[model samples]
Target: MKEYASILSKDGLKIATFSNHFRSEKGVMIITHGMGEHSMRYKEMADFYTNEGYTVISFDIRGHGLSEGKRGHTPGYEFLMDDIERVYAQVRADYPSLPIFLFGHSMGGNLVLNFLLRKPNNIRGAIVTGAYLKLGFEPPKWKIILAKLSSSIWPTLSQPTELELDALSRNKEVIRKYENDELVHDRITSAFFVNVHFAGQYAIDHANEIKSPLLVMHGMEDRLTSPTGSQDFASNSGDNVHLKMWNGLYHELHNEPEKQEIFNYEIEWMNKLLN
Candidate 1:
C-alpha cells in the first residue's frame, strides 16, 4: 500500500515522503533521490523492494520536490543532513526491531556518505549508486580559490552552469514528466554547490570511520560522477565495503537496459545482509 506523508525537520522544514509497506514487512529501506529530481521517480524501485518483503520509504530532500523550501536552495549545507536524520528517526520509531538500510543515488548518494560520516552508527547498512566521492574533472587551484572567495562574498551569485549533457534528450518521456512536474527543480543555487563541496570533503575526512556494511555501485560510463570516487570510497573505507562497477551503463544504472541485472544484484546483496 502507498501512503503520502510529511515530517517536520529539526529546522522546522516539512519534508515530504512516499511509502510502500509490505504485508510481511521483512525490513525497511529508506531511499533518497538524486539532485533535481523528486522521490516519486523511485516508485518502481520501491515496488520491487516491497515485493521482496521490505517496507520502502522515500522522501524529497529539503529545497527539492514537494518539501518546504526554495527549489534547489538550503539555508545551510547541514539542513539536508538534519532532515535526513529526522526521517531516519521517524522510520526507526515505526519499525523499531527491523533492520534499516539507506539507499541513495547520485547527489543523494553523496548525502548518504556524508550522513554516515557524521553519524556512523545510525543505520545497519547503506547502498550508494553513482555517488560523487570526487569529480572526474577537477578544477584548477585558482578556480577553486575563486569560487570560494566569490561564495564568501556573494553566496547567491549564479555559479557556472554544470549542466553539460542534455539529460532530457536521451529520455524524452522522463524529461517531459520532470519538466512538467511542479515539485521538480531544474535550477541549482550557488549555496548548493558550496555545500556539496563541503560535504564531499567531510566524507573524505571520515571515510575510515564508516564501519557499517556498505555497498558502492557506479557505472563505468557515468558522466556525472567518476568511477574513481567509488573506488576511493571502497579503498579507504577499511574492509567492510563492497564495490560494483557496471560497464557501458550511464549514471542511472537502475534505469539502464540491464536494470534487471542491477536490481537482482542489489536484491541478492541486501538479502545476504538481512538474512
Candidate 2:
C-alpha cells in the first residue's frame, strides 16, 4: 500500500515523504535519493523491497521534489542531516520494535555515510551506492576557488550541475525518462556544493568509527562519481563495511540492465543480517 506524509525539519521546512507498507514486514528500509532527484524516483525500488516484505520509506530532502524549500538550496549541510534524523525518529515512533535500515544513492549515499559518522543511532545497517565522495574527473582549480568564494558571500547562488545525463545508465530508456522527468533537475547551490564536497571527505576520514555493518557499492563504469572513493572508505572502515564494485555498470546500479541481480544481491545481504 502507498502512503504519503510530511515532516517538519528543524528549521521548519516541510519534507515530503512516500512509503510502501506491506501486510507482513521483515524490517523498515528508509531510502534517500541523490542530489537533483526526489523520493518518487525510487518508487520502483520501494516496490521491490515491499515485495520482499520490507516496509519502505523515502523522502524528498528540503529543496527537491514536492518538499518546500528553494530549488537546489539549503541553509547548511547540518539541516539536511537533521531532516534524515527527523524521518528516523518518526519511523522509530511508528515501528519501534523493527530493525531499520538506510539506503542512499549518489549524494544521498554521502549523507548516509556522514550520518553514520556523526549521528548516534540504532539503525541495523546501511547501503550506499555510487556515493559522491569525489567527482570522476578533476575539478578545475578556478572553479573550486569560485565555488568557495561564492558560498561564503552568496551561499544560495545556484549553478547547473553539468552532469552527463547519458552516463547515468546503460539503459537509453532510463536516460530518456530521466530527461523528461520534471522533478529531475541539474542545479546545485554554492552552499550545497561546498558542504557536500567536504562532507564526503569527512565520512571517509571517520570510516573507522562506524559500529554497524555498511554495504558500499559503486559501478566501475560510472562516470558521475569516482568508485575509488568507495574503495578508500571500505579500506579504512575495517571489517564493518562490505564494498562491491560492479563491472560494466553505471552510476545507478539499481537502474542498470542487470538491476534484478543487483536488487537480489541487496535483499540477500539484508536477509543474512536478519537471519
Candidate 3:
C-alpha cells in the first residue's frame, strides 16, 4: 500500500486530500468521509481497495481533519458539494482513463446524493453508507425556526457538546484514539446542524432524480443516522439502487469487525458494474 497527499483549491480554501493506491494500473475509488471525522480514518479501507487492484483517494472536506476552515461548519449546504466536485475534478485529471467510483459515508453519503441529484453524470457509480436522509433527533418546529434565525445572527454558535465516549462506547479503542486526536472536532456549531437538517430534507425531496447506479448500506444496529435513512434512499432511488443491511453492525460499517465482508461486497459490486 502507498499513500500520497495533495492540496485542492476550492472556493478559495485549500482542502487537504490523502490517498492510497494499491496497483498503479487500476481504476480509482474516491472516498468522502462523514461529519466530525477526517479522511485518515479510512486508511484501512483505502489499503483494502488498493490490495484489490484499485487506487483509493479521499480528501479532508473543509472544516474537518487536516483541511483548512473552522471545524464542523460550512459556508452553506452546497459548499460541501462544491468541495466534492473540485476533488473529483482533481482526481479525474490525474487518472483520466480509469473508471471512477464515489464512496461516501454518513454526512458524506448525504453530500454524494446531493451531488448526484445536481450532477448525475459525474461518476460511473456511487456507494452511500449510513446516510442521513432523515435525522433521529426530531427537533420541535419552533426550534427549527429558531435555529435558522440563530444561524444568520450567530453562525458559529457552539452546538450541544458531542461526547465521543458516549457515541463510541462500543469501541473503546476508537474513543481513546479520538479523545487523544487533536484533529478531530468533537463540537459542532448551530449553523452546521441547521444546514445538515436542511440538506437531509433536500436530499429526500430529490432522491428519485438521481441517475447514477447506487449501492446503499447501513448497519441494523446503527443508532446515529438510523437504517431508515438507507431504506428510504434505496426505496426512492429507483431501479439502479442496491441495498445491504448488516445484522449487528453500527453506524461505521467500515470500522466494524465484519468490515472485510462488507468491503468485499462493495468491491465485487463495483467490479461487476465496471465490467
lDDT of each: 0.79, 0.91, 0.80
TM-score for each of the candidates: 0.91, 0.98, 0.92
Point out where model 2 deviates above 4 Å. Answer: none
What candidate 3 gets wrong by more than 4 Å, as runs, is 1-4, 8-10, 21-23, 160-169
Angstrom error of the Cα, residue 94, model 2: value is 0.5
Tens-digit lDDT track for model 3 on 166-203?
A: 34325667667767877777667778878877887778
Evaluated at residue 140, the lDDT of candidate 1 is: 83
TM-score of 3: 0.92
Candidate 1: residue pairs that collide: none
How much is 187 displaced in model 2, in angstroms? 1.0
Clashes of each: 0, 0, 0
After superposition, the stretches of candidate 1 with alpha carbons farther than 4 Å from their true spots are 158-162, 165-180
lDDT of 2 by residue, 75-182 (tens): 789998999999999998888989999999999999999998878899899999999998888689898898899999999999899989899999999899999999
Cα error, residue 123 of model 3, in Å, equals: 1.0
Model 3, global lDDT: 0.80
